[model samples]
Every structure is written in structure tokens, then in C-alpha cells.
Target: MNVWREDLLTRLSAAHSATEVFSVIEREGKALGFDHLAYGVRFRYPLSNPRIVLLNNYPEQWQTLYAERGYVKIDPIVMRGMVSQIPIVWSEHYSRASNTFWEEARQFGIAHGWSQSATDCRGLQSLVSFVRGAEYLGSAELTANGARLSFLAHAGHEYMCHQLARDHHAQDSGELTTREIEVLRWTAEGKTAGEISILMGISDRTVNFHAANAMAKLNCANKTATAVKAAILGLLD
Candidate 1:
């Protein structure tokens, strides 16, 4: 890797909080010639109600307008990220579905942009987008920086995932042991105590014991709820 990429990854890995991570991204993004930067993450475990986090240096009014209009739900770039890992350059031709959104983004001096996405083993999906007003991000530019941009997207996602998971665990008020997590993960797959015991090579009573402890730690009323809670908290990941 180049010095620029190595240094940026080092800084990102050392970042302990969301703000610190955002700062690292902003600095590195500007160094790469972007005028604005945005990073967004979404969790995929809950299936019922997923969690999303966004960090951006966009204009305040644009941010407010985007949120107020629920643009996240309809952003074509985001939709593409869900199914493919391809890097995308912003253009009205490809963003016909969200023409108005793209137009408004241009009004905020976001005329040229590119985005790439990364998904982790924990089912956390992250997208990094860089935008500028004057310079167009053409094929030549993408060819020059594509590898580094993809790396940034992945590393940033991993760092942010670790920080967010730590914070969420703290807020959950308890921690699960390795055995507890293992048992809960299997349980989430509809495994009963007997099945879990066979899979884990433990007694059924032991399986129940672990399940009971996990339920208590998670403050769940039953095993079903415990499994769901664990999945939602990304423990299954």
C-alpha cells in the first residue's frame, strides 16, 4: 500500500469514537480531492427494524432536507449498494429514479461524486461517498483511485462497526460470554435445547443452563426473545 493509504488505515483503526472516525475520513477524503464526504452504515440482523447510522459534512440545509424528505429510503445509490459492490459515479442519466434528489444535491454544490460500499461478516453494510462541485469524477479519475477508495470504504466500515457495537453493548447494560453467544446464535436458528446439546456436544441440561443465563443477561422473557435480541444486537454476527 502507499503511504497515504497505510497512514489513513492506521488512523481509522485507532479511532475510538464516531467523531474521531469522521475526522479521519474528512481529512483523508479532502487529501484525495473530495470537497465533501459522507459515510453511512446499516445493520441487517433484526429483519424487523434495522439500525442505520450516517455521518456527513454536507451543508446543514441539505442534510435537513434529505432527512425530512426520507431520501434514504429512495436513494438509488444506496439501493445499488445493497446488491452490488461496484463503485458508482453520480450522474443524472443513471439516477433517473431520484432526479429531484440529485438536482437538489447539485444545488448544494455536489455536482460530481462517487460512492463505494462494503459489507462485513456481521451483516453491517457501509457506504462512502465523495463529492465535489467543480471537478468531474471521470473514468480516468476512478481508474486511478478505485482500489484506494474501496479500501477506505471497507476499513472505515469495520472501524465504525467496532465502535458502534461497543457503544451499543454498553447501552444494553450487560455482556454475554462466548458460550452464551454461541448457544444464542444456534437458538436463533430455531434449535431446541436437545438439538443445541447434540450440536454443541453438551448435555441438554447444560444447553438449557446456557440459554437461561443468556436470557437473563439479555433481559429476555424467553428463549425466543433472547435469540431475537441477540440477533438484533449483532451477537449472532
Candidate 2:
């Protein structure tokens, strides 16, 4: 393994907060020649939500659209990773699914070449996505780097979860079910009900129901406010 990969493993083992793990992933993306990186968690805990911290270089417009349109639902790459605990390349997902959103993603400079991995951190799961400015990668290159990417994803999730667990401030009031937590976390990450529904394999109505329940428990007026409260309560970082 590369020195950076080893370093990431060590960091994951030692990280005491989500912010610290995010930093390591951001740094790794820059070192690995990728243009962008994002890690999002789906779990019952308030802090275990689909929070994404950019590594720089991703276009502002793309980010805005991604959040505004709730693209996570239609993002096959993310969906595929969530269901499986394995490293994957973007092209593999594209080959299996077709959606209008994928075309839209291309227009936003997010298509073509990418790789991703899924990690199960304790009972929570997350995906780490990486994008490059190309259409494809050779089998040889993919073979050589696949394991490394998996390592990064595993370490990143471990580090983030460890940090969230250790930081007392990260805890929130009222425990939630796994599905409810997943919905709330994605909502806090700015995903729309429709988007969350798609990502979680549920209906839009179901997504809204979960959000409403979460809002009531959190004593918030709206989704936006609920998200803010989640952040303040250290449910997200």
C-alpha cells in the first residue's frame, strides 16, 4: 500500500471526530489526482447523516444543483454503493442503470470517470465518491487502484464514526429508528423528500412522514429549521 493509504488507516484508527476524518479524505483526494471527493453517512444517529464536505475544485454550480435538486436519489453511483460493501467504479454503475439525471450530471461536469466505495462503520453505512475528468479508466489501472480506494473508504468511515461517538457534544436528544435517522440525516444534508425516498428505496410520502416525525421531535417549524437544529445539537458536523 502507498504511504498515504497507510497514513489514512492510522488516522481512521485514531480520529476522534467526523471533521478530522473529513479532512483526511479531502487531503487524500488532492493527493490522488482526483478533482473532488465526498463522503456521506446513513445511520440512526443524528450525527450519522449524509453530510458532505468538499475537497475543493468541484464547481459551485454543480454543488448547488446537487443539493437543490436532491440528486442523491437519482445518483445510481451512490445508490449502488449503499447496497454493497465494495469499491466500485462509476462506469460500472452507468452500465447497469440509465436515468435522465445521469445526463444532467454529465452537463454539470460530474460524469465520465469516477470511482466509489461503500463502508459499513459499525451499524452505519456510507459512500465515498471520487471524480476525475475523463470517460473511462483502463482495466489495468482499475485493478491496481481498486484496493487502495476501498482502503480509503473504509478508513474514512471508521475515522468519522469514531469521532462522532467520542464527542459528547455530537449527541442529540431522542433516539430514532434506523430508517428515520437515515431520512433525517439526508434531509439535514439538504436532500429533498423525493430524493431521500429514492435513495432509501421508499416512497416520497414515506420520506415526508419521516421528516415530519423528525421535525416534531426536534420541535422545529420546517425542514430547514430542523436541519439547523440538527447541526446545533451536534447531530451533524
Candidate 3:
């Protein structure tokens, strides 16, 4: 990596707070030819209601307008990002479905930009968008910086997730033992205690014991939830 990119990643990894992290991203983004930066994370568990957090250096007036209009739900670039990892270049073509929204964004000086996304095993997804008002986002620019930009997105996501987890106390969480991990791993594969016991050469009672302990540590209500959470958190890996 070039010194510029390498130093940015290093600084991002060591940032002490959300503000500090975004500050670094903003400074580096400007150096890379962008005028504004935004990062957003969506926690997608609890299917009934997912939560989202957005941090940006967007103009306050534009931010208020966006929220008041409930634009996130109607933003096509954001919608496409939910299912695909491809970097999206903001343009009339991609935002055709949300033409009005696109025009509004342009009026606020959101003229040209591109976004990159990163998804974690825990079903938490994040997008990093670097935008500027002037110069078109040419293919040559994307061709040159795509990989580094992708890396920047993921590095930002990693630190944000870690910081958020730490800020929210785990409530005295304990590490799952090797046996507990084995049971949860199999449980995540949709195996019952009886099946797990036979496969691991243990009693069904022992399998249930491990699963229950894991559930307590993970604060899940049942074996299934425990397994799912553990696997998603990469405890199994």
C-alpha cells in the first residue's frame, strides 16, 4: 500500500472515539479528492426491528431535510447496498427510481460520489460514501482507487463494531469453553441435543448442559438463539 493509504488505515485503527475516527476519515477523504464523507451502520438482527446509525460531515441543513423527508427508505443507492457489495457511483442512472430524491440531493451539493459497503458475520452492515460537488467521478478514478477504498470501508466497519461493542457493556459475559463452542457450532447447524451428543460421543444431557451454559453467557433465551448469536459473532470460527 502507498504511505497515504497505509497511514490512514493505521490512524483509523487507533482512533479512540467515533468522532475521532470520522475526523480521520474526513481528512483523508478530502486528500483523496472528495469533499464530504458519511458512514452508516445498520444492525440487522431481531428481524422485527432493525436499527441504524449514521455519522456524517454532511451539511446540517441537508441532514435535517433528509431525515424530515425520511429519505433513507427511498434512497436507491442505499437500497441496492443492502443486497450487493459492488461500489455504487451516484448518478442519474442508478437513482432513476428515486429521481426526485437524486435531484434534491444535487440541490444540496451532493453532485458526484461513490459508496462502498462492508458486512460482518453478525449481520451488521455499513456503508462509506465519499462525495464531492464538482468533477465527475470517472471510471479511471474508480479503477485506480477501488481496492483501497474497499479496504477503507471494511477497516472503518471493523473499528466501529469493536468500539460499539465495548461501549455497550457485555454484562459480565464469559468466554465459551471449547466444549460449549462445539455444541453451539453444531446447534447452529440445526442439530438437536440428541444428534449432537451422538456425533460428539457424549450424552444428550451433556449437550444440553453445554448449550444452556452458552445461552446464559450469550444472554440468549434458548439454545437456538445462543447458537445463532455465537456463530454470527464468529465464536464458532
Who wins the TM-score comparison? 1
Off by over 4 Å in 3: 47-51, 92-95, 120-124, 134-151, 161-173, 189-209
Q: Name the lDDT of candidate 1.
A: 0.81
Please list the C-alpha lDDT of all candidates, in the order they appear. 0.81, 0.67, 0.80
> In model 3, what lDDT does residue 27 have?
82
- Arranged by lDDT, best first: 1, 3, 2
Top lDDT hit: 1
lDDT of 3 by residue, 1-237 (tens): 788667877888788887788787788678779999998888654445665778888889899999999998877778778878888888734535567777778788887888878888767788889998889988899888877777777777888766655554255258999999999888888898999999999999999999889988988899987886676566789
RMSD of 2: 12.6
Candidate 2 CA-lDDT value: 0.67
Clash pairs of candidate 1?
none
Residue pairs with backbone overlap in model 3? none
Between candidates 1 and 3, the lDDT winner: 1
User: What TM-score does structure 2 among the candidates reach?
Assistant: 0.59
- Model 2 residue runs over 4 Å out of place are 2-5, 11-17, 46-57, 95-99, 113-121, 165-237
What lDDT score goes with residue 129 in model 2?
Answer: 76
Ranking, TM-score, top scorer first:
1, 3, 2
Encode model 2's per-residue lDDT on 87-139: one tens digit a residue.
66677777555576677667766765544554442455666777766546668
Q: Tell me how far the alpha carbon of residue 168 in candidate 3 is from the true structure, in angstroms, after superposition.
A: 6.0
